[model samples]
Target: MHHRRPKNLRKPLLGGGAFLLLAALNAPAAVSFAEQRYHAYKISRPAYQRQYGSWARVEVPAEYRVNAIHAALLHTGKVLLIAGSGNSQKNFDAGTFDTVLWDPVANTFKKVPTPEDFFCSGHSQLPDGRLLVAGGTARYEILDGEVRKAGGGMRVKNESPDKAVTLKKGTVFRSPSGIEYVSKTDVTVPKATREFEVSYFGNGAMKPWKTKVTAAEARVFVEAVEEGPQALTTQAAQYEVVGLHGEDADNVYGLAQKLTTEKQDFQGIRSAYEFDPKAEKYVPVDPMRDARWYPTLVTLQDGRVLAVSGLNDVGDVVPGDNEIYDPKTRKWTKGPTRYFPTYPALFLTRGGKLLYTGSNAGYGPADKGREPGLWDLEKNTFTGLGGLTDPDQLETSASLILPPAQDQKVMVLGGGGVGESEKSTARTSVVDLSKDSPVFTDGPDLPQGTRYLSSVLMPDDTVFTSGGSGDYRGRGGSDVLKAQFYDPGTNAFTEAAEPTVGRNYHSEALLLPDGRVATFGSDPLYGDRDNTKLGTFERRVEVFTPPALHRGGANRPVLGNGPAEPGADGRATFATEDAGRIAAARLMRPGAVTHTTDVEQRSVALELTRGRDGRSVTVDVPDDRTLVPPGWYMLFVTDGDGVPSVARWIRVK
Candidate 1:
């Protein structure tokens, strides 16, 4: 069942004049507070000094929530999205589904036909510009035909069986089955069971696959693939590109499901094949470490095919064990895993650090969820992100290494882990990934609670979070299908228009071509839902337009005094009760790279923005939030408006 979102939340896309940025108001009356001592860091960008301020307020119905999200990039410079279930969060032959695609230019989510599969893990655009997708119990296309660069989608039934994959040159597609056809008749078709196949094409959308059984090939330990199941998952991912580039969307990477007896003595594995579109036959690359299901494969900028995370040992997560395949070397290297096991998600930072977040104890699919965790590629370490602290109205937390700016910060949103046990949480935590102090601090809480949410950073540093579990902790509560905003300027969050419908398990919020946002997810509340083996998916798609570009500059100086006692861990402590003025103190050090402190007490509005001109000092009464607590603190400074800016160092408690 697919449906379009309601009207109120569907604020149409703003044309040229429809957009405007609200100016910052410094109208707050100045109270006669005592002054305290302080050290100010100078900011060079004056045009942004006062302007980098921000604030956010919730704007939607209090109850609506979001579930799951599916995202893809189109050649049209747009992001196509599909969502499912807020009420039930269905997907797996469970609940209803919706479908929609967003046009960033028009700022609209044009509703499309219901998705064919409730569970599709992979999505990619074809050389002909067709969309290639893999995942679900089996694979099939929601598309109508062939893919061309400029044209829309077309449906081709000849290769329409589950798990048919297509790749275009320059497109991010991989597989052992991507091959070229010697003849149209020569095609290696997958068997009818779950033994799916992924085929990559370089010239045409696809090549002839050799489906016919070859005794000669079988005699040499080659098994003939008859009817195949769909792929485990698919996205526009290719093998890693090391030094130079080679081949193209030349190979196909996907899974083949099989019966138990196939490898009973051993843990049977679905074959992972690569079809060379140029070569037109199935070339066996390395199989997944063995029977791991739903693995995410990404082609690093260096051209290495790194498999992210997925279910192993009967649909559960086996932490660490990052599977890597080298196209040039045609081999596999299992990357380091975090802890013994983790359900961590893999994300690349601006510095190319493969970051994994969230974790689970014991068998991920079976046992309990743990506190937030992260895997750092650069350090080869696994550490906690936040604690049991709940992130409000967020779902399935996400992290992004922001592009450099006044608001440079690693943002973490929502909470929600596996199954009914782990539902929604209402906490939004932002961590300063800098080497020194100010490590993890609670950012603005989500207006509501959610988890399994989606967040992305724009060029200007503005961040967006949308859809997930309503409670947001991910421990099983209300399914949420809504959108929100994070203004790095004020370090606050704001909710968008009301969620037209509730989405639970299957939905996503994606960015569009013209910079608008698209929200697509499951909606069991709708009608005519299909109950397929894949899952009861939803596709209630919605679009959102931003208020205007709010490019923030340097962070404003805190109204606290500093140079206080530090902590063993290195965070600075500010005790307002012990001082005359000021509470929070911000200190930044660019040259020495260490800044930490607390106001002497009783201080406000230090105006560190002028530090770049020289050193700006001010006195104030310590802030209550700072001095009231008895802990170490750190002084940090930023030169941005929309977010906290400049940090010199910190003093721990």
Candidate 2:
């Protein structure tokens, strides 16, 4: 019934009706917003947090924030975050390297003086609690189209047996065809190797020995002094030394093949250093024999470190050459030659052999060195194990030594196809390395195909796995926000509190002394869903408090005074108020992690004995150095409710 009384009344009535209609139309959005707010409130409540756990982003000051390519839990209860040029071309060009020391307990950050680009380097905790970091990027990659000058590896040979010839940077070498190339760095070509050959006579009498001098060679990166195709060398040719005169010029020469404007891969450096946790400084060490990028450093049973697999100084695989570092001598010696892809998942077994989980990060041929096996360093042999599912999709996978080092079970989590491929896998496999055959068996699958998943071993014996991308470098907005806890006892995964940040390539997660997990780094190729925007490196740090930590208030057992340094196979007493409630104790090796590979993390169960006075607990440390590597560990005791106490730092000697 339309009744228009007056002009003003008609306008007022229409406005009121229109307002009512608009309110009705916006009801769904209002309800959705209200529901979202309620959900947020509910999750923030104590009960919800206690059940599903919680995440808190650390407020890192802008200047202190860095691209954390590698992270290590130092013995000082601080974390060493290394960026080292931070994957930025500008930083590399300006020689601006970065490192930061973060004290999680104190919530403080300090900028460290970095000496070199430690990006993509490998690290492991030394027996004395020092972190041994080896290898780094020497030169950034230059794509095909963007390259202006032709460059490649050059072999400088020394024919004289006198002494090594040192060629400084900018030393020029001229091709026979009249093109000039310059050395990018200083190169030392060793003197020729002298050998003696003795020829025996018919009566077994030795004849005069003849000496033979083999040419000594050193490889260095060289580039054309001028840009374009004119400087390209299509065939192998001997190059004359530009400055050397007479015999020196004739004895020392350069040789190279195929210098062109094609793509140039990332070159590596021979620099190495050890981070002293107490001093909070990186002490320079003897450089590695081979320049390496993306290498893997595994601590041997004797506290020596084995370095393997990386892009060399010339941007090629390191071949089968590996080396070992001895802390006693502060020197590196030649190691067994067995090639594996960069950042291969290698676990040291109690039997003194390394188990390769067939899991690796980037850079290798798909067909070679991809088999899961036991590497006998003594014999220099690798015995291949079978039954790994989705073998092709093993790059960027995460592997862990299942809790209780006595069990000797290793698991490989989700992975992706070789080098930027879209293929990924949800498959997980576990192998009982203690078994005679030790073949991988299918474990529970992930919810979806994932890569770069970070798995941390909890003191309570659960593996906290979180954050990965389904696509390469989280392309197409594929960063998975889910987290889960894999219970080795149950051989299944339980959903965990979802993480707000996305972690992908170059990211790492490690367990903190406070029973929480800290995650850092993610370099995505694209930032948006449409894949048009360039991605930014994630510098925000996130900490995840496991559900066990939130259980039944903060009444968890507390770790008091304990042995600062305990010998293996010895009994150590610790003061704890809740000793009577403590059910188990574990020595968890502090993690030195990078690129989703953390061979250092292992949980070794200790024999626990409660003191009669109810104020102390004694734990028997395992004598097996392989099981419990001599280093700093977080000694944690768990109560009957699976709640862990704050960790006590103990160095196992």
Candidate 3:
């Protein structure tokens, strides 16, 4: 039965008064003070009662090691967890790259060796059931020391000994190091003695340098023949450094430096690899044309994958260059595509165009490469969409192309300002691309603001959103405990049970075979948001079972047999316990989700025909790969009572 809102209450009411108002409003249209006020001005509305769900905290094996900086649900039903550095620059430098295959069925973790620091990398599931992991952190930034500003820029000395001087008296100068320098003015200095020494800053303090410079060089270094109170005094040189401001030509940026000095590894690698789940090892593939870190790997309609954004070999944005990896050729080729921002939430539209949702996973400049639009591959044109309220908050925001691929409505949910400097948002917006001109309008708002939210579309047509921070990267005690469900049918959000632990950046959640959702990973600020050294890394996994599964008894539809791989005819046979009562069938591509968006995730309703025996059925798969891309999908059969069956994995080839 459809629930209707009373005439007087067109919109939901807020607070304790909502319950009483909803009861009274349930009556026929009538004039009242409450109704008058509701009509006069829009008020903060109360959230709908949550379509309930339950969460189970799964114990992780102790040997799992690092947090899941990246995760994906593979076709083999095992989750791929990768944490190259595990969010620690020290570990990354130590060649501490780790990859693990987590088997949900066995509740066990198995180690897999990866080539490089795939930390902060991007990946997509290939048509052959392998995952293509691209780009990774090659080096780390070291905060050497503050260089004194001089000559309108930074000054350094050409001294070979690399002296750290507090200018006793002259103008500051720079040398081959290209590090910053501070300028100081002083009268004159008598002669260099044990009284003055070169000093450097390290471990949070200025230490004296062991080596001493000649009096002639020292006089030229400080440019001071006389010394006084206003005069910059020198401390003993504690250290000799090649670079301080990170401005060295070899460093690329002021930061990107090689963490490892091994002969086999450089700072960044242009290498790519495919994970072979069968052998539990990563096999090397053809290297990418350019090295990337934090790029977005999206599987295209043609079964090839597109790699976009991320820091290049020089530790800068990859510029306008984008590449496509063909599974057939097992190679990457430069594509005729324009640059989208690093890690842009790119969705493959039904029209085969890539849709940049304007949401990104915290890389590149805030003002550049972000625009909500459809990127056409053939014509290389982008038709932009406007009317979004907070484009800035789109960073780390989550978005989804609503279920049943036929409907081109896309919805963007909670996000926040770039990086950890800003607050999270509760705002929600939706755009219907089916219209001639699509513009985002306000949808139901989140109960509270959040960022880094993982919104997974469930089999029942409701979106299950979990694992986000109320603040940026789960800091400020902003770990969101509660989960929620979004029902397109009601166009509202309902609260669900919160998970056992806090989840933030590097966290992930995806639908499981038993109709439950698995959630794990939160490596924010190395897991120590609070100053207390007792910080803990979130490695334990949690599973959430929606209310639909709790309906109990034998009412759940059970599929007996179906084609593991369906061809162009798109026919798959199945014997279901609830065959006669089967209401509908759906083929949902299992999501290979990470960050905030799942590029290849989608759901398509299948045409079902019940066999005459009332114990068998035939499903018509989508012949058009455009509608149902050639990939693995979860085939679900929903009974008359609206309960979905445990999905049968199938390949829409």
Candidate 4:
């Protein structure tokens, strides 16, 4: 039955203002730690150090209109930018959805048709290179209507004909429906199959589901729904109850029988569609069993996508029971029944269990219930893993399973204090999830506590962190333009080049094929909640050139020939000018990141063996799905100094 959540279930959104106390106590201490490390490495270097990376701003032509509320790096090498309502409630109500395609190679943007108001929808790339977009804004709730209520009563009809069994008048039997009712007058029952009816008292505000049953040798049946109370009286009979629609119907919601005209509507949509990159349009598919908003989609090893928690049609959180989308059948089937905080940052482990890093994208229950853990999908169980000093501060923080896929370490960094407040955290943590009992431990801190930060795994196995705000939604002068890089070897973050423009909420970055990182989109308030002008709606695109790109022309190796496709006898042959000097081969999945969560970003190190001819390298392809799932990948070969060559796109399937 649908019921209001407990008072303790709700949590505050992460923000900057809420972290003042934390910053005052921790910021100075962090500074002292940095001073101690100055002798080891220059801690005060300028953000634009040439040894790190260089950022260049690119202007978009006027004809291109974009808000970039949503973005993804497509397999075709174009960035898909979507902005429904441009973050405006009025536009959302009007159903104004916009989309654009930005081609980095061509340095141009083109307008594209939008499928629906996928304002807060969730998406993940399929193995076929298509993007599966699920959920959207069905409608917005406005508070202009009066509260509605209903009178309670119950009635029953006899289906089977039989001898009359007399029922006494004033029979105080309860109505087994949402309308909490009690018998007002009990009348004599006719032997020709006696039927019963009862009037209920109260509006059935709180009731459980009722089902058909046999009581006192008489059969009683009611429609099985999330509402309608099950009669709980001193009655004796065998009950045969039919299950409700959808698996886990009780917790699925949207089955409430009670009517409440008073509603704050912002309803979530159940529309499920596939974006065909080749056609550059969305193809409608079967709708999901439940409406979802602010959901997260993760691609499973078998190519199906597991869509986790989100708000339901009525804007209430859909507590648990995630669904899976099968690409082959083009249908959504009920997956393992489980409870997950909305948009949980889940990573598929080598063992096939899902690891929730405790860094949810946004919204859902907080407190201990949302703690980090490893979820055994097959058994529908969770193993809670604690150790985060500040779990409440991870609302917009970026988390990732560190590079080289083999390393089972996951990291969470920078977030706000609580709900839409202006306080954030510079704290970062890492945990080796492979451990039997994993727990997060403190890692290097960021330059300052931040939110909306984006961390992309580079070809070199180091992570690149950029774009975020010191405050929530880039408000209160919390814009952070400088970028940083995290080295797993040292567990340290080094300042990198600063971008020409600042990016915070709604911003994103991805590694490009040419070994540079493309950064764009920052719609904190101009087109988001609060609608306050904290920073301009970011439309300008920029690219960050990693230090490897600064090497001498001769030192930068070139791909003489493409590597063999994956699954081809598990061997790949590559020809390059620096083949003799090439020390490593790696495969990097193109990024499809949004909301600071890049569920698609992954890297696999390939075994490199020099060819007998001394002019080519024979790399052994990964045969296990855990190491390299079927999909498109950018293969890069790095020299002894770690300077990588331009990537050659190849399919692992």
Give each model a TM-score: 0.43, 0.96, 0.74, 0.74
Q: Model 3 — which ten-residue stretch has the worst lDDT?
A: 252-261
At residue 287, give the lDDT of candidate 4. Answer: 82
Runs of candidate 1 exceeding 4 Å displacement: 1-69, 78-305, 325-333, 338-343, 350-352, 359-388, 391-395, 403-408, 471-483, 523-537, 549-653
**What are the lDDT scores of the predictions, listed in order?**
0.36, 0.92, 0.70, 0.71
Model 4, residue 608: distance off in Å is 1.0
lDDT of 4 by residue, 71-150 (tens): 77777878788786666677776767888888888877878788688877888878888888998776554453432222
How far is 125's C-alpha from truth in model 1 (Å)? 10
What TM-score does candidate 3 reach?
0.74
Instruction: Tell me the tens digit of each residue's lDDT in model 2 across 1-653.
Output: 99759987888899999999999999999999999899788878878787789999999999999999999999888999999999999999999999999999999999989999999999989999999999999899999798899999999999999889999999999999899999987888889989999999899999998999999999899999998789987899999989899989989999998898888889889999999888888999999999999999999888999999999988988998999999989899999999888889899998899999888988889888988899999999899989999989899999999998899999999999999999989999999987877789999999999999999999989999999999999999999999999999999999888899999998999899999999999999999988999999999999999888889466999978877876454888998899889999999999989999999999999999999999999999888888887788899999998899889988877
Predicted candidate 1: what Cα RMSD to the true structure?
21.6
Cα lDDT tens digits, model 1, 46-156, are 322233222222222222222334465443444444333222323434645544443444544454444333232333222222333322222111122321111111111
Model 3 lDDT at residue 82: 86
lDDT for 321 in candidate 4 is 64
Off by over 4 Å in 3: 1-51, 143-268, 526-535
> How many steric clashes between backbone atoms does each model show?
229, 0, 21, 27
The segments of candidate 2 whose C-alpha lies over 4 angstroms from its true place after superposition are 1-32, 203-208, 567-569
Q: Report the error of model 2 at residue 187, Å.
A: 1.5
> Residue 412 of candidate 2: its Cα lDDT?
94
By summed lDDT, the worst window of 10 consecutive residues in model 2 runs over 561-570
